[model samples]
Target: MVSPHSASDNDNENGPGVSLVEIEPGVAVVMGDRPLEALGLPAEFDCEVSPFQLMPPGDIQNLADKISLATGGLNLAAQGVHGVVSARGLVRLAPETMKAMKSGLQPLTSGGKNLGVLVGKGGKIAHQIRWVPATGAAATNVLAALGSAAVTLALQSQLASVSKKLDKNLKETQSIAHTIYGDRWYDLMGLYKNAMRAFREAQDLGVVNQHTFSLVAADLSNLEGKRGSFRDNLRRHVAALNTDQKQQLDYIRENSNQILADVQAVLVAEETWRCFHLLRTAHISCDTTMDPALKEKQLAHMVEQVKREYAQSMDEVSRITLELERMCSLIAILPGKRSISFFGSNNTRNDGEVARMAATLAKTVSEMRNRVHAIPEKPEPKVKALRRNVPDDVLVLLQYLLPEDEPLLALAEATCYGEVFSGSDVYLGITLTQFFVADKDKMSQEGIIDKMYPLADVRYVRFQEQGSPMLEMFTKTDNLSLLFNWWAASGPKLADVRRIRDLFATVMNIPEEEYRDDSLFAEAHQAFAAAKTGMKELPRKSRHSAG
Candidate 1:
């Protein structure tokens, strides 16, 4: 157990018999003080500090939460008061003294004025002091007096409970890792150490407040969550191996390395997620009423952190994508009957484990793909506010293009301007009755020109591949067959084109089977196959044509 007394815990006569001795970095015992006046209590109202460990666990967390909330309103450091007060003792003070203390801590109450002692307290003091207890009508005031240390103590207690579960998880996880990786276990061990270093460092700092403690707790929890996955993956791999195949050191090493790399990638993803979570929490905790400059700085920090985490997450997604592609290429070469096999069919086949790993990889990739798609399209200087793939400017225009009674279903914009189509911008809008493509540019002073095509008239949607694929909507109208190109000019990215196409299809209620791979292309493919068998020369279209 950590000692409850600090090196400076010397008793002096002038002050109360006690000095603060830290039992935890953020928690301390008040050995003695001169009199109530030195610690901000009335001169006649003498009180002694008692350890809060005697309190129930639920009460500790509740008290810590209250203290954390109260610190936002009061600053204990400015008052030159740094010792703890027991919740039990606060009620014991002389009624007059208790009244004075409550009045002093009144800022902790909603609409209460700032206490003379709390005016100078800010983030600095919020992190420094330890002892405080809140109860009764003055509970908020008392909690404020406890300082952030009370929250830290509560957090540490929570960590102790979580740690017990982690210990068991890690022991089992380590044994499985050792069994599979053999001498290579050292690599995973290093990752485990890296994961744990944060918690150890926080404990050593001896002054972790709730936010700081929360960050370390996230790390521990992430590690614990990963333990089961790692164990299951490695165990599945080993269980699928026969006695003879297990001896194939080269294959074993390769597979082991791949698993380790995957785990490391996942850890990076978890860390990124943790950062995003922290940023969100920071945003919530930020004092809107605080100094304008400080709030600006806080907001800027959060924005920068969000950008960094996004970039890191994208990098991980790319790495995972490459791995998936490679797996696909390997699967493609297998015999039809053995296509379900993973790693390979013959000697290398570990169907049970490798197939399961493939499924896991597929799930991970699907989730990452969804996240990537959910990201808002980046805006160009010329265009603005492309939120959720729909530009604000386009949505505004949608109102003018569609009938007043028509309800908008979905909207998306593509940067298909000026190449194939004479426009500075393009937008696709969908409604229950129909979908339309609107083209607008600076030269056209008149409003946007749009062609509305009924949903029932739509025959097919397909990509016309040139330098960049252009989405074409084929429609039949009263003996006329027409193709309307949803111009994906040279400017629109492949991703942008796909997003527009998918959104359009979804709003039009077109089945994925029809739009993704339309039957029209299939008919053409069959016709070409028959023509080839008859030795007829089918002219290959030019590479640069838009239509």
Candidate 2:
């Protein structure tokens, strides 16, 4: 063991006011009771020291022997120091090495002093070990370092826990997807998992700094984007399933909720860590600067940056939280439909009371569609498009059909010919807020009949029979039925019809299976069966009947 008191005696041999003691063969532990700078070393923590073992522990008196014996000894001790510091506590060392170190540490404790250790090749004993009895800035730096390390480790542990949760959630999602979609969604799920894989790889690199943190954040952002698309596809696919198939995949909604929760946890951890990282960098920069004026300026700039980042990060967090909440709300209400009218409501109308539609002039419908196409794409575009596209005659007629104050989202025109309407052509003009019709024979303003039912008000839609296919929508106000055959129309394609159907279903939250082509026949058959069951009598033969 060594101390400042023994330095004078060993000065001539070691160096002026320097003392070193060899506690093991070829290895020395330098102990001091004075500040490192007072014991002849730089008064800073950031400097590097040259290796000392290759040189003599003393200036002369068997210096050659000392140098030969201590060769590579400093390197081993340096490695041990690094391991202990990184571990943040005592670490198990080789039995022989521990015994030697314990012996070297023995005499230093009687004074009740704090000890600090530094290690590097080629430095004076004081350069390798510091006695930090001085208080103030040095002590604060040490404490700050310790605090930052602890917080970093805590964030890492939380992140690991969140990652494990994410893994479990991902597995659950995969199982549900396989059950519902039969492995067709595996490629889609893989896209998100691959993004997660990149995040994990970036994290595994020792020591997360600002750069690595940014990379991981970007990976998570990418995963979020992919997840959004995946969710849309999942919703559409589920909506297209039949009742029995939908029942089989009921667990999907719950699994999706779990996945979203896991993702939220990940993002919170990442953003919190990034905040801490930036603050730590700022502190380090402040501490290393020499000029007081410059340091203050640097600090003020850092504070502004930190405040800006915090605000931005909080905004991001709020956005994500709101998104997750909205998604959860949507999933919670899935597999449910709007109420159907045939169930007999107080507001139900008799067949005679149901209003019939009138046909619009062909020239009017054509002009309206052209106007719709020419509307600009922004600033209440949909509303503007509808208003600008409505022909003067149609608009004047709508005032009598709907409330003048009601808002319209869009306008569309379709030509339909059906045998049920006596093989007459029907012109259907649809708006998000209402549908107006004009029949082929009466193409005048007096012939047009408006069914001003809002899409939002529609609770259910029934598609009945292929011979004269028609859509009957039951809304809060009234039921409106349309006989449509776009195949006979020159303008709208099947895609356009589908677009309108999808828009209606989305607004009504009606499942795709409820309105699909193949399923419509079954739906119509069920409706007929229900009606037949409720019917009081069969039709009787008239005198004009051939039978």
Candidate 3:
């Protein structure tokens, strides 16, 4: 109904050319067709002239009213003239409203003379309507506006469908992911779910330690750029990684492969991703057998990743340290050692009876200090301070170290007059403290461990009877050295009741029931058992019996 053409442009009967519909105020609709779309009209008010065309067409009457208003028509007849009906075809109306011109609105015949608008005309005498044309950029802008509106609705619907499908798939994937890979499956499975995710993390159910690897990686990038003074620090991080770190890294690789598959489907350089994959696989290939020089080079590169990973473990230890100590302390008071070990060494013996120790020694030029002591703290302060439950605990702790070579031996003997009783807590406390210092010394030496032989002549290397190696070593010496300014004199030790409760809890975790003290008696018993278990009787007695 609306076109750029004016009613009087052809009728210049007496005046200059004039616009049929002016651009000011709200657009006005007349028995003319030039103002349907105007210049500089705000985007908000366009094609939205009626919700019927923009939305679902349920209200015909409402559409008619909007059209009338859009064309500035006061009556209903002029409303229909200002609009074109698109439900069927683009039909121009006579100069009347759908309500008023309902009777005269007619169809066009195919006589080839264009009898469309004229068909409805010359019959009803109410009013006259004419087709109009718009020229210049105005027409283009209007069409674009309409197109944009239509596309918006279409895109909205399409997006809704996509969202529903994604949610369904996500749930199914997550459940299967958990069932399949435990904590790691979703992340790896996420890679294969593409319809690819833009980032691998989108599908991850795997634990992401809140460590900002970006910062650490950035540090590595800078460190590599220096390439001059990075060797020593690089070695420190490299030595930090153990077999456990490698296992975690392998799990991450599993997820990355899924990402690689997802990226290959659409990325331009599938080859580039593949090359990058090869590079990563090469990184994982590094092992103990690599050439020393090559190992060092890879270690430098690996430092970045290793640092990032180790920081996570340190964080984990910090989180559970309190809980772990509480649990371990509980077990310490239990009547028996809950866990067992069938290995080499015996855990418990008299202080002087520690006949052998499988300690390793490293001859190094103490980069940090001169003659690194077995125990970091001075024994003098501890000997002077008396503890409530663990009296002379410091002296007992010093006994784990050879103050000069046999100072701990003399101290142990002096404390008990050679009648060494088993009720002393001081020795246990000292043992853990000595372990802390020794571990620190080991680290400071860049993992150059010293195999100190206290009972160097002992029969076994590993402690037997303690079921769990972790617990066995832990009872003798915990990682208390890691704590800053740590000392037992500062507070009371764990209560006996709590200690017992915690021991039971640990047993539950290990699924073990009775406990073993790992005493000398037990070790001797195990040695005999092992000897008996491993020995075969001679054939003479057996042959006689058989005969």
Candidate 4:
């Protein structure tokens, strides 16, 4: 147990009666101030009164030591009584004055107001001296606001950085789409669409700030517009290709039919000759009175006749087979079908259909080859001069327009630009080599032509019934339609239209007879006209309707 303070503790003269001593690391006791009861301590009782350990004693002592040293031995001491410590500098006291010390007196300079300790005499603390200047509350508030602004700025910068990254990704996706071919372009388009959707979602969710969202949204809109344009262009190209394929398919089918017909004709001729020879042989063999050598000679003559007929048939078959081979080769090399799907919707034929068609063509070619092999071989005929049966004026125009190497097979003249039905008159110079559109006055005067389209680029030609009969030539390379109108007072004479159409069909390897006989071509034109009428009528209805 600790001993109690002695009565002589109050007899200090050189120093204050009270002195603070550290009881632990942070706790301190006022050793000689008073008994436990005097400092309002319970009698259950502590031997001495202690201050609360709010701060470490070493920290307070260090502050005190620094002040004493700075003030040149103006000795400062901490006083602790009943869990409270005085912040004032030490006070000098006589024996009687020590009893008047009051722990409740507020220090003249508290730590909140000043840096230095306050010096006191008796129960009162004097004014503080030798301390740092105090900062105003407004200055502190401004510093806090500045710190918050800095943090907000950092968050915004991060958001902007994220938005920039998204923009870069979108651009990269678009660039990739431009570089990719085939179906991969569609894949990249899908990715770009998804990315735009994600960006919009993020903006809606407040993951991106308004400024960043606006900038990115604008970029997305522009990119999406470009993407839409690209898709539209691609769809148009695919549709054009589909039309070309259809034309090629029709040409192949027509050629196949012709070849098959020729083959059947040759077979029929062979069978006819075989029956004739057999009957003649039977007739000769049945004559019992004829000499054996004479009968044999007659039979040999009959056999030679049959051989000649068979040889002719074989020659025709061989020519048809060669033509079939050429057609099949062209079919085999035609462009493969390309398919593009947007968001799981496909509007074009896949490659498999093209492959199947090619396979069927190949099988037909093989069948023709087998039939040709079954026929006896014949020596090829000598080359014959190709007769130029074309019109003299048309021939002259073709000769003038075409290159030297290209042979002019057929030509026709027709009025062009019949759609306008008025004003400037133009004539089209149609040949196997190229189609020339020239103004009649210009050709007769200055010799100026509007345009020349090569027949090689022409995919299909159809007769369109406009105000006048128009020959619509669909070209592959430029994806354009060329219309040639025939000049006739009575709404374009069918004879003139048929003449030009026949020439075009002959040049394009399409059978003219099919176009002449089939009503489907006329029906298709009517359907197209009806669709156009319907489209125009819809808008008119909407404009005038009460609803």
Among these predictions, the greatest lDDT belongs to: 1
Which parts of model 1 are misplaced by more than 4 Å? 1-185, 208-307, 310-352, 355-547
Q: lDDT scores for all predictions? A: 0.39, 0.36, 0.26, 0.37
Report how far off residue 171 is in candidate 1 (Å).
7.9
**TM-scores for candidates 1 onward, in order:** 0.25, 0.20, 0.15, 0.19
lDDT of 4 by residue, 244-266 (tens): 32353344443333333333323
Q: In the order shown, what is each candidate's alpha-carbon RMSD?
A: 24.3, 30.6, 32.4, 48.2
**Candidate 3 structure lDDT:** 0.26
lDDT ranking, best first: 1, 4, 2, 3
Which ten residues in a row are the worst by lDDT in model 3?
A: 358-367
Alpha-carbon RMSD, candidate 1: 24.3
Find the candidate with the highest TM-score and give its number: 1
Q: Which 10 consecutive positions of candidate 1 have the poorest summed lDDT?
A: 1-10
Candidate 1's displacement at residue 494, Å, is: 39
What clash count does candidate 1 reach? 12
Q: Candidate 4: misplaced stretches above 4 Å? A: 1-253, 337-547
lDDT value, residue 537 of candidate 3: 57
| Overall local distance difference test of candidate 1 | 0.39
- Candidate 3 lDDT, 51-70, residue by residue in tens: 11212234223333333344
- Writing each residue's lDDT as its tens digit, candidate 1 over 1-547 gives 0111121212211212222222222233332223333343222222322234323445444553454345432233222234442222121122343344445533222122221211112312111222233333334554344443333343333233323433443453344345444655564454445534544543444332355445444454554455445444544544433233123222332463345344433433343344333323333333345675565455456545544654565454444433333333233322242323222233344333443443344344433322211112222222221334544454443433344356766554544432234433555555677765555452122233345667766665656545545565555542211122334434444455565556545543444555565699899999989988666433334333535
